[model samples]
Target: MSYHAIVIGSSAGGLHALKTIITGLDASFNIPVMIVQHMSPQSDNFMSRYLNQLSHLQIKEADEKEPIRQKHVYIAPPNFHLLIEEDKTLSLTVDEKVNYARPSIDVLFESAAYAYGKNLIGIVLTGANSDGSAGLKKIQEAGGLAIIQQPQTAEVSIMPQSAFDACPQAIVLSLEEIASFLNRLNNDTQSVAQPTST
Candidate 1:
């Protein structure tokens, strides 16, 4: 399948997991990556700046109504929930938190599932809470690919474990393996024609 977009969620030990994944993606990686990594409301843009410096893809805090584009990593800003509109653009909301997070991972994944349907990839990485499980299931129900970091390898296993519990068919991989898999998907999309609508 020629996936159009990727949605990732993490918490607690997310910085390292995110960096490992982004570092493995070279400039040739073409899909837009939307991420929600739980952070304190007092947090600044330091995470974006750090990741941008380390990744080949541009990383920035997603802006309201911004058009989602390839070769960029858009991160949910602190104190807001980032969502994908039906038009494939981005919209940020300050609505009540889900899973105790303003930038809730479930919110992003659910919206992306609606926007991209089967052309979406939802990944649940290292995290401490059960926030991403329901959204990963939503992605699966929408026929999108679901990937979870192997619970054994996760710094905090609860999140990945919860996702696996919700969607047993999700591909479970280690951090390094996840990056390799994503790269392979990128290469496949580059060589193959976009899949025709069924």
Candidate 2:
């Protein structure tokens, strides 16, 4: 669908799945990815190191006011909410938790909605709570695409189930399927932009 950005949300059993997807993506993938993975404050820098090791793409624990860039994967810092700004940069805060998740998926999805609108692609993966449902819906409301991992295949089904119950149009598929879909989408976008030889 030619998305300019991808926003992903996950919790339980997400580390392996996320790594699998990111590692499968091409190194030059032009889409910027932002993620909100529910984590304890004690786990600070944990996901960063894990994902960095799993994928060649630049992966890091997001910092306050960090600028977003293509081909980079930005993970919300533990216990902080990550937001997208109008100018295409990232913002972080520790105001409060939504659905008991300080790095709430709703905050990232909603802010991404405002920042990228119709150009955004949202994905909800494994989790034990309903934190990402509202945010995924927000993305769709803003004319962005929404994807959810198949509940049956999810390590923890509550998150995807919530998304399913909330939005019937979401594309629910396995993690590998999602990656293949994104890879095609990225290539399709690039193809349309490249001028044919004269």
Candidate 3:
């Protein structure tokens, strides 16, 4: 039940959903979380601040070369690509857009798979576009887990629908169900860290 990292992707109608899911996670969660929510450089800085206010966790726009932490949530700053480094550090790239987004979900997911291997968990949230679909598929291909919001329950169904089509086996659940699932993962991961015998 333990993983090295978690990567999430989202677009339109994502703000509230993102807040809900991240806020549901407790401060004791020790699995590195990285997010690539489609945004513009001129976008409001409220995402980090808002989630921070709502959750017990620390939320921030990630800095280049910063160490990725399990108990913290890292949001890709508007207009940058977030990648997970093998050394467990955050990497930001200014490369051309993928799927028409500077902070493409595909970029983050692919890089996360490369960095975390079987220890990656990718979640795709509400959005109007199909940005996170490719990334979610990659996570599945890399022996990791993929979760998508139930399209019917999403504010914007296209994103979740796209991910569902890409990875049919992905866990499709409601926002509350998604919250429950993540919490279980968080607790299971923490339990493993305790001193135990083989």
Per-candidate TM vs. native? 0.96, 0.96, 0.95
Q: Total clashing residue pairs per candidate?
A: 0, 0, 0
Better of 1 and 2 by lDDT: 1
lDDT of 3 by residue, 1-198 (tens): 578788988888889888888877766767778988888778867899988888887889999999987688999989889988888899899999899998899999998998887788999999988998888888899899999999999999998999999999999988888877888887887777785677
Give the per-residue lDDT of model 1 (tens digit) for 2-103: 889999999989999999999988679998999999999999999999999998899999999999998999999999999999998999999999999889
Candidate with maximal lDDT: 1
Model 2 TM-score (2 dp)? 0.96
Q: Please estimate how well model 2 matches the true structure, expressed as its whole-model Cα lDDT.
A: 0.90
lDDT per model, in order?
0.95, 0.90, 0.87
- Residue 26, candidate 3: Cα error in Å is 2.4
User: Cα deviation of 46 in candidate 2 (Å)?
Assistant: 1.9
lDDT of 2 by residue, 31-80 (tens): 88999888887786888888898787899988877888878899998888
Error of 2 at 186 (Å): 0.8
Cα lDDT for residue 137, model 3?
A: 88
